[model samples]
Target: MSETVPTPPSPTTRRQLLARTGAAGIGIAFSGALSELFTGTAAAGNLGHGGYGPLVPDPDGLLDLPKGFRYRVLSREGDPLRSGEGPVPSNHDGMAAFAGRHGRVHLVRNHENRATGRVPVPVIEGLTYDPEGKGGCTALTLDHRGSVLSERVAIAGTAVNCAGGPTPWDTWLTCEETEDKAGTNGYTKDHGFIFEVDGADPRRTGAVPLTAMGRFQHEAIAVDPKRGVVYETEDAFDRPFGLFYRFLPRKPLGGTGSLRAGGRLQAMRVPGVPDLSSIRETGARFDGIEWVDVPDPLAAGTPIRFQDFGPRGITHAQKLEGCYWGGRSVYFVSSYARSSEGSAGDHYGQIWRYDPDRRRLTLVIVFGPDTDVRLPGESPDNICLAPGGGLMVCEDGGGAQHVYGVTRRGEVYAVARNRQNVGTPEDPEWGEFAGVAFSPDGDTMYVNCYAPGTTFAVTGPWRG
Candidate 1:
């Protein structure tokens, strides 16, 4: 790639950017030892800290948490649980951390599958799903040392258990991002909705589905403390374009974690046409502050469609997937374009930010077809804020994808190349480590993915 990413007012070709070497200009310099290891396989099987701290559970060994943090293999892809009450499903998506009994921690992890009746033989009540993404979620409890105390099946019969956010009251807001029938969706009867998982006490109750979050193709979950509103992203751009929304619980949060009997769901609308100039024009900028009220969020033809960023809008939108809150901002990413529809503005990928203070949204990083000479345009998937700040984008796009980072000043660098050492263009698994998380202290990091389906931890001093 290019040595120094153009600061401004300069048109650079993709080739120049991909020509960058061992250590391109991303601020600090790489040591001689570190430089040689940058593009090699040795680092893949070892701890990689990139521009931050060390990665725990060295790739050479098994999954083990670093010193300060702990981990437990709650459930594996093909593992059976709960006396075979149900078969363990695959594709674990979103997860959250909460305070358990006497200071222990609890996690409500999601499984993304649309299969049904494919249960792994020998049924387990609260431990299995329809296997075909028929909508299911799980809960696991662990102590401070990373030892899993117990595991249980929360709720079954939900599809595409995509990513979700944690609520203020120590509960996970899991979302079913896909329609139940897959044919005719966008209604309450189907699978599109957000539910709550109470991790404190099992005696408190099992899984309780919350339908109040709406029935559109759900994605990430975010909460706005300023207004006691829970923000959500929609991957459902059937006709009018996907939407962003907020749910105001009708009853206080102490309710029975049921969406059907809860608050109101409202879609978001930017006040005035948001000025995306900060990204497009480079200089002809505006704060990008805009707001839209749902008005009648429950009505299918409600006025929520006004939120799309367009002359009203454009072709099918970039399906927004992951989202989280940090430093007073709610961040999210848009997946690539649909093949059915042609040139999606030839967009590689972009990350957008929403500021609660100014009540606006802005597109930040634009990783185009110049990411790497090995393979261009890798689909950027979910993302998490780094402990040292910035973002760790999980690249799911094809060939030679890496977990890359972007600074507020517009600098980008690869933290670790996810491609294994096997060496081959047809590498069956180039990048599967999609989900990334940090310990409470932000000193340790963990990552997991679908291919071969494994989780990793890396520990060390990564902050500048």
Candidate 2:
């Protein structure tokens, strides 16, 4: 991994530039130590000023929230589901909340179960994409008060359904994070495809794969509601690195908001940046970035990221994980670039903002190695913009795991902490927070604990 630091973006005023960049609403909170490391002056201390000062330890030893905040365990693994076919699955990764009937919110969540694990959703003849595959999505309806009304297996028979984005027309696009081939591993159909599930009608929903989107290990996606373009990220950890993609819907979402009609897929390419290793600094920005059409949208064997597509100039990241569409920019995370284990690249984490209007990509936040255990560095996985303000990041790094909050002013704070210790006494109270999203009303926030598979709905004074 190279430590090359290219020239930073033109010296623009931080407030003037970042505030108007539409990143203020991004869900990416860092530690207070990161704030002091990046910026010279620290406006806020360990926890942001406006946020609830510090997290009060939970009595249940599950989730620790602020003084005025409390969380309810909405769903857990092995619990009886409304579908009656199976119980709630483990490893809840990515999720989205949609407006439901009678002022309720419908949450479509992905189960990141691999082929070897038990199938989360039952195999229906017409609905199952691959019967042997053990990954899919589940839907839960929550009342206006943030309580779970009902839970059901929404989609089933997919392989490693990891992370995906919600459609403006009310639907969930679940992606498979595996490239497992068919006829192998007892799979009758190929894996590594994005499936669309109706958020409202999960019971009768049709599980259809959007093959036009390239087949790869997809992590997360963000849809541009205005242009109807969908931005996707891949969790590629191999040599070549993963390419960021955007799908241009051919007909856009009509009354149905279905992506089944198919579309063209393109990869992002930084023209001037010769190779993908030029971006090394915290605030590096590239101008006039372009997109190249992927040669084969549904190509197998070789993924579009590594395939010899055109100039092969698509900028690749170590592990592109979470992505969310902000007011005008697409904020994406590169989960730890330049690994110590020699996987590839440098830096622990980076948040890049793609400005479609300026046709440029700006590096907003970068996480380097920090020695402070109380306020250590973080590797953010699944991220989303908080309704109150700033970004809430799910920490996947070492030490105590937390949902850190990054304010618009660049201040970092810990929003919530995980305190789960089940396996053994040696096993620390550590669990990664994923699929963090707030309800439409902005009063309730929903997140998941990856291991024991617990979904929590936290209601509190969001503005505080």
Measured by lDDT, the strongest candidate is 2
lDDT of 1 by residue, 313-396 (tens): 422244666777765677666654442333224344555666777766655545555433342233466677665555666666
TM-score on alpha carbons, each prediction: 0.70, 0.86
What is candidate 2's lDDT per residue for 1-464, written digit by digit as tens?
A: 00011211222122223323433332333322223122213222333564566789888889888788989999888788876767788777789999987899999988888766643666656667778878898889988777777887788889887789888888888989877788877888888899888767864457777888878888888888888888999876566777889999887765343566778899898876633444666567789888889887776767777777664466777678889887678888876755443344566678888889899787777765433333424577888866654567887765456787776556566788887854455434355778898888777889998777889998887762
**Which lDDT values do the candidates have, in the order given?**
0.51, 0.73
| Model 2: how far residue 314 lies from native, Å | 2.3
Residue 183 displacement in candidate 1 (angstroms):
9.0
- Those runs of model 1 whose alpha carbons end farther than 4 Å from true positions after fitting are 1-75, 82-87, 101-103, 116-133, 181-189, 200-205, 237-240, 251-261, 271-316, 337-344, 371-378, 408-411, 415-427, 462-464
Worst 10 residues of 2 by lDDT: 1-10
Model 2 spans with C-alpha error above 4 angstroms: 1-50, 203-205, 255-258, 274-278, 339-344, 370-376, 427-429
